[model samples]
Target chain A: MELIVPILAAAVRSGTPILYATLGEIMTEKSGVLNLGLEGIMLIGAYVGFIVTYNTGSPFWGLVAAFFVGMAVNVVHAFLCISLKANQVICGLAMTMFGTGVSSLLGRGYVGETIAGLQAVALPGLSSFPVVGPVFFSQDVMVYISYLLVFVVWFLMYKTKFGLMIRAVGDSPLSAEAAGISVSAVRYASTLLGGGLVSLGGAYLTVVYSHMWVDLMTAGRGWIAVALVIFAIWNPLRAALGSYLFGGVEALQMRIQAGGTTVPAPLLMMLPYILTIAVLVVISVFKGRGRMLGAPSALGLPFYREERE
Target chain B: MRIKVEKRFYITKWQEVCIILASIVLAFSSGALVFHFLGVDPLEAYKMMIDGSLGDFYGVSETVAKTIPLIMCSLAVALSFTMVVWNIGAEGQFVLGALACTAFVRYLYVDNFVVMLACMGISALLAGGLWGAFAGFLKARWNVNEIITTLMMNYVAILLLQYFVYGSWRDPTSLGFPMTPLFPKSARLHQFFSTRVHSGIFFAVIIALILWIVVRKGVWGYEIRVSGQNPKAADYAGIRSTRNVILVMFLSGAIAGLAGMAEMAGLHRRLQPGFAVGYGYTAIIIAWLARLHPLAIIFVSFLFGALFVGGENLQIAMRLPLSSVQILQGLILFFLLGGEFFRNYRVSFISRKR
Candidate 1:
């Protein structure tokens, strides 16, 4: 019981960045554009965020810069996949490569640099509560914002009229166009918004989590976030839960390694990826039976208006 | 006036060349903008890159040595991509191949040079093939997504390699660095006098030639192309796509495994953590850039090898990050992907109809 609070706290802290990425990808996938460049975008965001904060001395400005950088990168993706109607998979992979290369190149100067990170804020009334307070309320401002963003994304995805348009576009762009919805506009906006959120997640890693710059620091977390969207069946609330679940596994691995357990550290590090694959297989096995198979029908397909049946 | 885009039945060769040239120019200009932002002269840096990679005998030899693995891995990707299997686990398979080769050398200890080399080669092929076949089996049996499964397997293979390198395989005399003891002299590949270029290049060419002939002329090749273009049509014609996917994936993994064996035997002569850097990932780009043609892959791989060598030189000469080359590669791929779209569809400026 004594160890549970710290573990849970670490879970939330580590999970927040993934939550941000998963939520962002959820939005993008909901719009029927699978941007596989999340890992690369996050890397660029981390670099830009760290550089901005290092120069400006404010994490706020750093996050703002990251958001713009991510959007700029995704704009290239949208132009290729949307306007030109290129193969989405290959284009997405290219975007990731570009992001990773450009970020690593530009971030060379900032290696090992340190800055003041965002501090955890204690809520006045909630501070007195024991396990729940420390685990949930006593994280950095970004963590609280992530909690809010989860519900915000959920409401935006399921509640709003705009949400309806995104689903319509994803499910059938032709049908949506027939109803006067601009499929291209919705995809562009969603992809950009998703990019912004992913960048914010990257900023959080630099400003709040690591508080320093490193190349390839996101380290495949973006890929895991992509898998998380599938695991959550594209629901934002489930995405939050899934991200924390992965975070819990990551935290447990660190704690065990620190505790001097006999298990090899590399083996422990393989947990999340192995689990992700297992879950993907299970999802595939149970596919087409019910609502559990929640992939967007038109996901990963390029939209074309003139093609005949 | 307005612009109209229409799909073309076939793009002319001259137009294709023009599009490729235009993409190259655009990519270079963007790279130049980046270089300018970083306070370096783009032309000077590019000149240095060329000189560093291909100017001297030493540079040329290094580039050739690098091309061995690139050629093998690119062929691996191209073969599976021919069937649309998406075997992104070549990196993992490569590592496993290296590990398998190392294990045979370290534990089996055959004295005859020819037999030992043969054993290592076969071990690598079998290990890589089996590893690849696992993903193919999953896809065949359960309809799983090969992209994610293969990607996940890459991490597993790397971690498994790390476990051995850091644990029982660590050389006792090396002062605690995470590496295995060097293989015996007989186990090493025969290199040309005073240069790193080894017999692996010969093996690569032979294998590529074999694969090219098989893919172009063999019955299996016909079946694969048929299944890839239209699986339902192939099914109607009595072609079994599931068997083809598994077989193609195994062969693909085997070729990548050979790449791993080549790198281990030719370059390092010992197992190390960072032995195979991003060759497998880069092969994906090379395969696409070469249009999945094995013969074209060889020349493309050499060009990429030069780019990698030049990237390393940039770190020393201009104080630029080695990732500068990666950025250039990425930009080139982006332009190429975009260019493929324009190749299929021609955009023309037409007067607006009133």
Candidate 2:
């Protein structure tokens, strides 16, 4: 009973980064552009976040810089995919390679450098509650932001006129175009904004989770987030559920490892990835034909305004 | 005047060559700019890269050695890519293959030269093929995304390799290094011309030729082409694409595994941490540049192999990181992808429909 609270609390903390990334990918996909470059964007964001915080001594600015720089890098993907109408998958893979290479090169000198990262701040009243408060409210600023972000995203995706347009563009760009929406504009907006949020996920890893820099530190968390996006069925609320579940498994793994279990660390490390595969299987099995129902109809397909059939 | 983008029909071979050349030139120019900012003279860096890879017989041979694994891995990836399976797990498959070969050689000591190599090779192929087939099975049965699954499995495979080499397999006598003891002389592959070059080159060449022939003339090749062109049509034609998916992935993985076995037996003679050098990832780039043609894979892999060796030289001669080569690679991919727009469509300014 006592262990559950800490595990949940740790789960929320661990899940926050993925939640942000999942949310970001949801928005991007909702607008019909699939950017598989989230892994690369996250790496750049982590590097920029770490370096900036180390230099300016302000983690907030570190995040802001990372976000914008991430958007700047995303511009290439946008240009190649949207403007050039190139293969989205290949472009995204290239973006990953580009981001990884650039970040590794730039971050070589800054390796192992520590910074005064974002600290935890518990809300007085909410934090005092037994289980929920500590797990949800009593955490660092990023965790708090992630919570607000979930609702904010849900609202934006479900309620707003812009949300309608984004989903409309994703579902059927031709109809959306006929109904007086600029398909390119909507895609560009979602892609850039979602890209910024994804960058924040990476920034959180450096500015909040760990205080020091390491190469390839994101360690497939970005990829895990990619899986989470699918598991969430593109819903922000479900994304929270999936992220927390993954986080709990991670926390439990660490707890078990800490308690001195006989299982090897490498084998333990495979748990999350294996869990991701298992979850995908379960989702596809249960969801059946509707497994990918929520996916944007125009996903991975380049929208060419001129090619009217 | 509004600009109109029109799809071009029947592009000339000259135009195709020019476009490919332009993409390369643009990529190199961007690479040079990166080198300039990194405080190295871009011109000198280019010269150094070329000379280091191709300057002498030794450099050429070294590049060939690196190219061996690259060719095999490229073919592995290209095979899956032909069916649009996106088997990015070749990295993991490669490491797993190497590990399986090591385990086989270690536990089952066979004195006969060819028999030992054959057993080790078969085990490696099975390990890698099964790893690939697992993803294929998931995709075939559950419609799972192979890209993410394959990519995720790579980390698991690499970690598994690390666990073995760093733990039980660590050599006891050699200053506690995280590698197995040297293989027996029979286990080591035959070298050529008193150099690091080995019979692996023949294996790579043979695989390339065999793949080329099979893809062009074999029954499975026709099925693969049909399925790739139109899955629905292929299905209607009674092509069991599900089986084909698993089969192609297995072969893809098996070839990648063979590359691992060759690297371990021919070059290193023992599994080490250095065995997981991003050849699988680099091979994807080769596959893309070669347009997934089996013969072209060999040529492209050789070029990339040169770039890798040159990167090593740059690391030694100048205090530059090898990641600079990675950056160049990224630029090439970006340019190549961007150039895809040109091949498919052409934009021209026609006076606004008046």
Candidate 3:
């Protein structure tokens, strides 16, 4: 029972951060931009949010600060890559570096410190349930928010006209532009919004999970989130499922390590990455070409508005 | 108001040098600004960095010591990039190469210096090339995305290293630290100078020059360039793009693997978990910023090496975070990439939509 509870708790905690990142990535990718800078942006967000929350003693302010910083970084990215039609990969990489560097430079003072963390908000009626109570009902607001965002994004992407336009823009700017839609604007908005959400996820890690600021604290979760985007076939809901599974695997590894299993920590830590590749290989084999997963038709191709189509 | 358009002449060689110099200055200044913000004098911090990296004989030796692996890694990425293979798995290749060379050093009993060097180098090359070829074969055969596959392989390589260090190769006397036993003296790379600068620098330079000649004057280089620039056109021109891509990836991975050997033999003398301080990943940025030009990589790589030394100094002297140095790197990449827009496209404002 003790082992089970800790594992369950670990899974929930681990999954939330990945859930935030994967969902955010799904949104940006839906609009035809592959923001590889999520890792860097998340680091920055985690730092900024932690600093703010520690200073103000309010989680809300911390979240706001993270959102603002994330949005600001996204603005730079959108301007250079989307508006200017520069290389998407390079721009994204730059964003990541910028976010990481800025965060580290500013966050130096906050190292080895703790802050006022978010309180777990138990759902009134749902919290009364037997086994599922702690698993689903009793959790911090960010955990519930991540779950809610998955559905919200799913509905927005699949069932709505706006979602269709976003998809269309990603598919072909020429067609979308001819249909009287602004491709650049939609891309910019989605990129920024996506960036903001990913940063919020980072902030949640610091403010809710660790209540501390540290260097490279996200520890490649950003890359895992990037891989999850592909693994889940760019679907926000599926991405959530993947995150949960990945979180469970990660949690299980930690539990076994804690249990004094002879396996090395590095090998245990590598489980998630190895599993990620395995899952990718299996999905590719079973699905026989995952083209229908809403992969942007013109993903990573820089759009030149003035070029003859 | 209509902005006047300026017509510019062809790009000059001098202009290229100027642009590089400007980039270095801008990147370093931005680095300094971070130090300034952290309550340290930027000038003094930079001085401290210089002092740490190359102010004295020992510092220069250490700087040269660090530069060899960097140059090799940069060359690895730069060479493959010419074929547009985008092999971002150099870090893994490096680790694999080190592992292979170390394995030879550990198990082998009789070894002359020359034979030992040849075996270690060959072992590294073979290991890295095989891994690189695996990624290439997947791309050619199944149409797998090389980026994702190569990246995934990196994790596999890292895990393999970690497993060995922590499991089979755990140093007996180190009190549970994840590292291997030290190599025999014969397996170690000979230092060129007393200051700790190893012969790896000479090897890297020679390799860079050879790559420059191959990319510039060789027929195979021509094929690689044609394919990288435009695959469809290369195919239409009767070039086997697939073979070239595979060949280049193999060569790239092999060179990166050699860098791993250099790190093990010249510096560390043993393998550990954090053996590579991200030299492979940083090489990607270096390759691109150098425009994937083999000759250009020499200057670009030295600049990066300086930044590494300088960044370390900034950390110690100014208490600036390590991430700030990475941020400067990102800014350089950003400006270079952003600069490419002007290189490739012209921006014009049309009348507002009525």
Candidate 4:
């Protein structure tokens, strides 16, 4: 009971960035595009966001800058995969490498710099409550925005016409085109929107969580978010649940280390990745057994209208 | 006017050469733009990079030393890529191989130089092969995506290596630093002609020759190619894809493992955290650029070796970050992939419909 509150609060705090990335990826995958460049985009965003916030002393402008930069970088991916009909997987890997290089080069001067991070806001009446208030209501404004964004994404994915069109294109681009939907246009829009959100996730890491910039600081969270999309089975609400669960594990690992557990630090660090592999294998097994794996049907395939037989 | 992209039946060799040249040119131009942003003279930077990597004997030897591991890893990636196995776990396999070699050298205490080296090499091969084959088994049995599995395994492998180095394997003499004791002189690889370039180059050459023959002419190679290009047809022809996937991945991993062994025995002579810095990932680009041909991989590895050396030079000489090389590598790959589109399809402009 004593340890529970802090762990829960930490979980929500740690999970925000992952939630952003996962939701953004869900949006992209729903449009039949798989952007494995999330790690790179997040890195670039972290750098750009930190730089902007460091210079302007405003986190909001930093986030806006990150969003635009992410979209701009993703435009290259969109062009390669959609217009040039390059292999999606290869293009994504290239984007990641490119982003890493670009960010590291640009971020050299800003290393070790610090900024005023987003402060937690305690709701007046809600703060007086037990675990729920402290964990949910006493978070930064960005965290609340994340909560609101979750519902917005859920609404956009399930309760809107545009959402239906995104799914239609993902299910079958040919059929969607026949149904009068512009497949390429929809893909471009979703990819860009997803890019912006992913960038925001990176910004959240720099401006809200770390409050300092480091090269490759997002670590493998972007990859975890990618894996989380599959684990969530492509549902927005499940993505939230999955992100929080991962966040909880991360927080618990830190606490265990701080508490000086006998387990090796390296082994403790390996937990999330090992869990990711285990979950991936289990999901694949279910999929192999003819379960309804919620992957977009045309996920990584480039849509070429005239070439289809 | 509107553009129409139509698939081409075949790309002529001349056109292929032109596309390759264009990709190289475009990549350089973009790199130049980046240099200009950094306030460096693009042409001077390029000249310095080229001269630094090739002008001096010391530079040439360093490049060769770098090329030894790169060629082996590139060959490893090329083998699996040929079979479409997607064994992106080379990084993990390489680390495991190094761990295996360190364990052998530390425990066995073999006296004969030749025998000790052979044992270390065998241990690396087996460890890496098993690590890679684990992912292959998952893919074969459960239809799992190898990309994510392999990638996740990299972190696990690195962490496991760190655990050993930081804990039980820490050299008592090194006072708090996380590293293993240096190997005995007999256990270390022999350098050639008074340079840091080791016998690993000979090993790379021999392995490349063997892989080239196996991939280009062997019956198993034919099966791998058939299965990768058309799985249904291969299945109808009675080829076991699952077995092929596992076998190819194991071999691929074993080869990459040799790179780890080379790095330890030839370069570092001890296990440390930064022993293999992204060599495995760099090999992926080399494999793709070489089109999975063993000979081409050798040539591409040398070019990448030069880039690595030059990247270091840039850091020391021009005050540019080492990541500039990574940026160049990324641009080259991006342009190459984009250029592949033109190789397959020809774009034509048509008047827009009113």
Candidate 5:
């Protein structure tokens, strides 16, 4: 039970960042803009969040700072892809390279520094419940917030007028523009919101999870979140579930390694990556029709308002 | 109140080329400014960069050696990206190809150098092509996003390398380091001169020239460009867009795979973690900066190779941080991308009403 609790605990903690990033990416994709800078944005968030927490000795401030930095990064992406209507993939990749390099250079001094991270905030009576309680209710505020964001995102995407506009723009920007909706505005807002959420995910890792600032500490999690968005078929709730499963695998690998199983550490490290590829392959096999998963029709295409010719 | 927008002019063909060149210069200037901010003399840095890349015959040779893989990978990326097929897993394909080609050279019972080189090249090409084809298949058949699939596969490929180097392929004589056993003398690529330049540079240039020729003259290339420009029109005209997507991806991946073989056979002589470095990732930048033109990729790849070699020299001689090169590269990319805005769209000022 002790081992099981720690494993579950690790799963939740490990999965939170991926959940955050995937949710953010899902929002952007829904608005017909693919933000490839999740890796860069998250790195900036992790570095800035760690620096702020280290200086302030408070994780909350770190989260706030990281969110703002993430928003700033997204705004740049929005300006390029939405406003300027440049190529989305190139812009995103450049953003990643720039973001990673800047963050690493700025974070060179804080390599091994530690900060006081958040602790589990379980409900009073609920904390004493069986496995179910520990697995779900007893967790960090970020994890709860992720759950809330899932429902909120789902509701906003499917229920609200803003959601409708977002969907309309994503499906057909030309038609949306003709219908009097501002495609650029919708795209810009979604991209910013997406960037903010992904940065919070980064903050969760540096301030609430690992509590240290290290160069490229987010490693490949940002990329994995991109994969998860596809695996979940752009559904926020499914994305959260996929992230938890990924976290569970990561948690299991750590446990196996700690138990001194015959498997080598390098091989164990490779397991999650391999699993990600496998899941992608399986998803491809099961994905009968392209539109069934609700992928945006004009995801990566740049919209040109004046190019009628 | 309705706002009257002025008519925007389309950038002329000549202006497009000029803007690209201007952006390149601006990118370099931006790089110099970054150096100035780091307390280094910008002029001295520029001189150092140029001199380091071509100061002596040896330096030129080293640049050539680095340029080989960059050229190959950039060509790979440029070819696929031109067809709207993003093969982000080129890095993984490169690793897997290197691993396969190296294994062939080491364990195979081939005595002839010609046969060994042929085997290695073919294996690398096949491996890379398969990796790309897998992504293309997923994209074409299931409508899965190739970007996510390709990117995820890169990690898996890296892990595969880690597994082999640390596990079954560990060099028995090296005691503890994670790497494969060195290939036999016969399997190694021939060096050109006193410096470490190899035959692989010739191969890269040849491949680039071949791609240029193919795209310029071949029926398939014409179909690809047409389909890429307008898939719906191609579909209406009875061209198989899916087939072109798969074929372009294969060709792209094959070039990157050859890059892996070049690293293993020409330079490294064995597989290691640092075998190819960031050549695959850097190639993405190179391809874009070149605008996915085969001829342009050839030149840009050499430029990047010079930057890499020169950056190392700057680090050793000028006491600048190694990451200075990356910062410079980033600045160039930023401005280059920003410059594209001017090419496609014009910023006009409207007088504000009081």
Candidate 6:
């Protein structure tokens, strides 16, 4: 019983970064573009976030810089996948490599740097609550923003005209075009927005959680976020649950180690990835491929408006 | 003014060649810009890269050594990609294969050279193939996304290797290093005349040729093509797509595993840290650059192997980071994808209509 609060709080803390990435990916995938380069994008964000915060002593600017740089990197993906109609999967991989390479090159001089990062703020009315107070309300400001973002994204994806256009373009570009919507514009915006949010997710890892930078420090969390998109069935609400569950697993791994068990570090590190595959298998079995699971119909496919029959 | 993009039914073979050449040129020029930004003279850096990787016999020999694994991995990736099944787990499969071969050498070493080599080769192929077939099995059975499964397995595979190397497999005699003891003399692959080159080149070349034939001329090759382009149609025609997926994944992983085994037995001679150096990911770029053609894959892999060596040279000579190789790869792929689009679609500028 005593271990419960710390574990739950750590779960929320650990999962917030992935939650941000998952939400961003939902928007990206909802608009029918698969950005598999989240790892590279997140790394770029982590690097930039740490660098900017280290130099300027403000994580807010650090996050803003990371977001912009990430979008700038993703624009190439947008141009290639949308305008040139190149292979989406391959182009996404290229983006990953580029972001990884560029960030590493630029970040070489900034290794071992640290910054005073964001501090936790207990929510005004919610801090006195029983178990939920310490678990959810007392976190860095970014976590609160993420909580707001879930609903904002949910509302944006389901409530607005732009959201309708994104869904239409993702499912059937020709139909959206016939309805007087610009498929290219919507896709470019969605991708740019998605890419920015993904970077923010990366920033959260550095500026909120770790307070420092490391090379490829997001590990496979970006990939985990991508998988969580499948588990969430493309819904914002479910993404939170899935992210926390993953976070709980990771937190447990850390806590078990802190408790000084005999298990090897590498074996424990393998748990999240193994669990990713396991949960993926379960979700895939129940979902039975994409269409039933509400996957974007044109996911990973290029849209060519000129030649369609 | 506006540009109108139109689909062209056919492009001349010469034009296709030109597009490919242009993409390579653009990638190099852009890479030069990066060098310039880094305060290095672009031309001098390029020259040094060329000279360091291909100028001397020693450089060329190392290039050849690197090309061997690239060729094997390229073929492994190209084979599965030919059928549109993404085997992103080649890196993992490669590591898994090396680990398996190490187990053979560690526990079941024999005095005979051929027997040791055969045991290593067989174990690697089976281990890697089964690991790959595991993903293929999930994909074929429940329709799990192979990309995520394969990608996740990569992390798991690397961690698994770390467990072995850092834990039980640590050499006791070598100052507590995280490596198994060096194999007996019989276990080493035969090298060429005083060069770093080993018999792994033969394995790479033979596999490339065999895969080229198997993919191009065989009946199963036709089925593979059909299944990739249109699975529903293949299913209607009574092609067991699931069986094909598993079989192809097995072969794909088997070849990659062989690459891993050869890398250890021929080059390193012991399983150690830094064993998986991303030849698997580089092989993806190689396969794509070659358009999945086995012969072309060899040619491209050779060039990438040179780049790999050249990047190493840059770090030593020009004080450039080795990540330059990854950047170059990304640039080349971007240009290639864009070039392919231009190849199939002709864009012409026209004044905006009033």
Candidate 5 per-residue lDDT, tens place, B153-271, comes to 78777887888888888889888998888888778899875568888988898998998888767887788888878888889989998877888888888888989998899998988
Q: Model 4, range B35-147, lDDT digits (tens) per residue?
A: 78967788888887888888899888989999999999889888888888887788989999899999999999788999989999999999999988888888888877787
State the lDDT of candidate 2 residue by residue for A142-181, as single tens digits: 9988889999999998899999999999999999999999
Pitting candidate 4 against candidate 5, the one with the higher lDDT is 4
lDDT for model 4: 0.88
Pairs of residues at least 3 apart in sequence or in different chains that clash in candidate 5: none
How far in Å is the alpha carbon of A283 misplaced in model 3?
3.0
Quick one: ranking by lDDT, best first? 6, 4, 2, 1, 5, 3
Report the alpha-carbon TM-score of model 4 versus the true structure: 0.97
Query: Model 6: per-residue lDDT, tens digit, B1-354?
Result: 988888898999899899999999999999889768856688988887899889999999989999999998889888889889999888998998999999998889898999989999999999989989999999999888888988899899999999999999888887988998997888889889888899989999999899889899998988998999998899999999899999988998999999999999899988898878789999999999898999998899989989988988988998777787788888998999999999989989999887
> Candidate 1 docking category?
medium
Candidate 6 TM-score to native = 0.98
Cα displacement (angstroms), candidate 4, residue A301, comes to 1.0
- Per-residue lDDT tens digits for candidate 2, residues B197-295, read 889888899999999888878988889888887898999999999999999999999999989999999999998887777898888888998988999
lDDT of each: 0.87, 0.88, 0.81, 0.88, 0.83, 0.89
* Consecutive 10-residue window with the lowest summed lDDT within model 4 chain B: B274-283
Give one digit per residue, the lDDT tens place, for model 6 in A187-223.
Answer: 9999999999998899998898999877778989999
TM-score (0 to 1) of chain B, per candidate? 0.96, 0.97, 0.90, 0.95, 0.90, 0.96
- Most accurate candidate by lDDT: 6
Residue B72 error, candidate 1, Å: 0.9
Candidate 4 regions with alpha-carbon error over 4 angstroms: A289-292, B350-354
Sort candidate 2 into its docking category.
medium
Candidate 3 clash pair list:
none
TM-scores for every predicted model: 0.96, 0.97, 0.92, 0.97, 0.92, 0.98
